[model samples]
Target chain A: MKRILSIMGFVFAMGSITSLLIIGMDALTFERILANEQALFQSKVLDAFDVPYTTATINEVFIQNVEAIELDVNGETVTVYRDPKTGRISMEISGGGVWGPIIGVLTLEPDFVTIANVAILQQEETPGLGGRITEPAYLAKYIGVVFNPDVVVTKNIPSADNEVDAITGATGTSTRFQIILNDTHAKLFPLLQALEN
Target chain B: MNRFWKRLQYTKWFNISKDGIFKENPIVVAVLGICSALAVTNRVENAIAMGLAVMFVVTASSLVVSAIRNFIPSRVRMITYMVIISSFVILVQMFLEAFFPVIAASLGAYLGLIVTNCIVMGRAEAFAVKNPLKYTFFDGVANSLGYMWILIAVAFFREILAFGTLLNFRVMPDTWVNWTVMALAPGGFFVLALIIWGVREWAKYFDVAAE
Candidate 1:
């Protein structure tokens, strides 16, 4: 009985020590991690705007045009997007992929007829398949895609509705991304019209 | 100190290489690490970077684990090994973030997934758990070389057909059409299966006679 108790005590002590070490390391690196993520997001946002500068330098370039907004989605306020120069609203769309999540920021021109930029925030689709959608080839496809009242993804390019080339062998991911794009347009189109009127 | 020095030079280097490359290969024979193998091999450059990173982590983790083996109680050996391994992984992550941010960005969370790689864990549990510090460290290094060579070969094939390049260096003539499917996950599965088949045949032909 004594031997067993002693073994258990040793195990508990080791566990405590290991846990404390991990916790301490995490605490030390927590701030750095957050700063890195913030910088990444800012860079992506600037990239979407085609601002030819680092996120740090973007402040000097477009100090007045872009403004970050929080959107109330089903009673939850999420950081939708920013428009640093014009105070124009941007919509942040979140969607699900076959394996994980895919979220992006779609900055719209005030007219709502064209997309200013699209930047992927997160993705975990199968690499080389669905993951290719996150590449510049696919992301570039979103730029200038018309955000009309009935925006939809279609394989046939130059169609009346919004059509971006679907990544071959990754139709599911393309379809999923289209669903989120349409949903965001549906909600924001009416809001923009009301605001304009 | 004298006995330690003697042990450091005790194991023959050629014997170590033979064991790691053929007898106990971490990838082909042991099947230890396939996660990052599949994820990064789509691009040969990424595969090379990941292989070198794994080599560094596996060697360093083995050295540390072997050094602390005596102090680690049997009841909590696994956690002790994990803590040591995670530390090395974080260090590798920081190094990559600082120097090769592009590769770092491409690898994404898969870099962190190195902690869960069976190769690192297997080395710690199987070899480092019993061997002396010196032999264990060398063993770790040798095993990593075996893994690196296999990954580079596999990635070479996958990247050339998939992307028409080797290590991002274009190989195929520009006029030739590339196979896009070779760059996808299915391509990785296909290529790995063929590699395993070839290695199996080689092993059979090279089977040693009774000593």
Candidate 2:
């Protein structure tokens, strides 16, 4: 009985101490971590829009150059950023990848049919395989690709303007990514078109 | 001078450090914590950051475990180590995310996964629980440095061969073409295996059962 009580007491003490430590750390870092995440997201948007800004000036540049449009699509609030200078549009798109959710930024030309850039904000995929989606070189392949009707990620040589090469060994991620892009574009393109007028 | 050297060698802390860093290296000899070793050794900068992070975690957690060793119950010992290690890991994660966001992002899931690194738990259970606080500190730092040096060595070759760069600087000539395969998982396996074999051979550490 004494041994069991000691074990229980130890477990309780250990749990409480560790929990308090973690809670203290989280409280200390909460604001800075949030700011860092916001800065990263803003920097990605600035890159897509071709606006040059240093880390110190990211917030200021974003505020001055980009306009955020809050739109209601089926009662869901989807916020998209637009470059006032070029009329290009950028929005966050997310979907289920093989291992976990893949979230990225998709930028479009003023026509809303051609891709300007694609930058991954967050991804949890197979490293060196599906994870290659986060590579700038891989994402660059999306640049200049047309979403006429819809985009297709193919394994074979990309003959059509709407087709981009899938990651060499990551067909599953590529297919899911294709669906994510098409679905997001279908949802947002019309709303953007209406706003242009 | 010779007597002093011999006496130092015989000291508990000195021997503990020697065993942790060289005689029983976490990677080369014991072969613990290979997952993050393989995953993050692709870049020199990454290896450095990971090494520092692991160093902090192992040292801090081991010290904590050692400090509270007497009060811990055997049945709940493993759970205690886990909680302590995880709390430290979260602290490290928060610190990095707040100040060194790039490194944190580059490490990705691996940073949080430090809780699962066998080296941290292995040291806590094997050494920290039995040893005094001062000796445990030496063991912790020495073992983490052991892991760090190996990671840096692997990253050194991998980064140069893969990108023709060392820490993103162009070390190779303009004519050098990047070896794409060197950036992949197989490259990590080959390099790590070679390192393990080389270190073992040099140390004359042969598997007795195999022999």
Candidate 3:
């Protein structure tokens, strides 16, 4: 009975001490971490819009150049950013990849059909394979691709306007990415068109 | 002077340091914590950051464990170590996320996964629980440095071959074509394997049982 009580007491003490340490750390860093995340998201939006800004000026540049439009689709609030000068629209698109969710910012040209640029915000796909989605070189291929009906990630030479070359060896990521892009685009494109009109 | 040197060699802390750094290195000899070793060693900067992070975690956790060793019950020892180690890992994660967001992002889930690195738990159970605080601190620092040096060595070769650069510096000539394979996982495996072989051979460490 004494040993069991001691074990229980030890466990309780250990849990309390560790929880206190983690809580203290969280309290100290919570604000800065949130700010960093906000800055990162804002910078990615700036990148999608091709706005010139250094790390120090991300918030200011973002405020001056980009306009955020919140639209209610299917009872969900979806916020998209637009570049005032070019009328290009950028939105966050995320879906399951082979390993984890792949989140990226997709910017479309003024016509709301052609891809202007793409920047991956987060991904857990296998590095150097499906992870190539985050590479600027690979993302550059998405530029000029159209979404007339839907975007197709193809292995062969892209022959159609909506077809883009997939990552060389990541067919799974490619297919899943295709579904994500088309799904998000299908949902948001109509609202963007309505806003433009 | 020679007598003092001999006495130092016979001391507990010195032996612990020597064993942790060379004889029982976390990576080379014991072969603990290979996942992060391979994942982050592709870039010199990444290796440096990971090494520093691991160094802080191992040292801090071991010190805490050693200090509180007497109070912990045997049945709950493992759980205690895990809680302590994970709390430190969370602190490191939050610090990096707040101050060094770029490195935090580059490390991705691996930063949080430091809780899973065998070295942290292994040291707590094996050394810290039985040892005094001072000896444990030495062991922790020495072992983490052992891990760090190996990571840096692997990154040295990898960064050069893979990107034709060292720490993003243009080290290779303009004519040098980057070895695309060197940037991939297989390259990490090959380099790590060669390093393990080289270090083991140099240290003359052989497992007689394996033979």
Per-model interface RMSD values are: 3.8, 0.7, 0.7
- Chain B of candidate 3 vs. true chain B, TM: 0.96
Q: In model 2 chain B, which range of ten residues has the least summed lDDT?
A: B202-211
Selected candidate, larger lDDT, 1 vs 2: 2
The positional error of residue A103 in candidate 3, measured at the CA in angstroms, is 1.7
For model 3 the local lDDT of residue A191 reads 90
If both were scored by TM-score, which would come out higher, candidate 1 or candidate 2?
2
Q: What pairs collide in candidate 1?
A: A65-A83, A65-A84, A65-A85, A65-A86, A66-A83, A66-A84, A66-A85, A67-A83
Q: If the candidates were sorted by their TM-score against the true structure, best first, what order would they fall in?
A: 2, 3, 1
Candidate 3, residues B1-211: lDDT per residue as tens digits?
A: 9999999999988998888888888999999999998888889999999999999999999999999888988788898898889889999999999999999988888899899999999999999999999989999999999999999999999999999999889999999999978777888899999999898998899988964
By summed lDDT, which 10 consecutive residues of candidate 1 chain A come out lowest?
A: A58-67
Worst 10 residues of 3 chain B by lDDT: B180-189
Query: Residue pairs in steric clash, candidate 2?
Result: none
lDDT of 2 by residue, B1-211 (tens): 9999999998999998988888899999999999999999999999999999999999999999999999988777898898889989999999999999999998899999999999999999999999999999999999999999999999999999999999999999999999978888889999999999999998889889864
lDDT of 3 by residue, A1-197 (tens): 99998898888888887888889989999999989978888898888787899999999999999998999998999999989898898899999989999888899999999999888888899877898888889999999999979999999999999999999889999999999999999999899889889
Model 3: lDDT equals 0.91
* Higher-ranked by TM-score: 1 or 3: 3
Q: For each predicted model, how many residue pairs clash, with residues at least 3 apart or on different chains?
A: 8, 0, 0
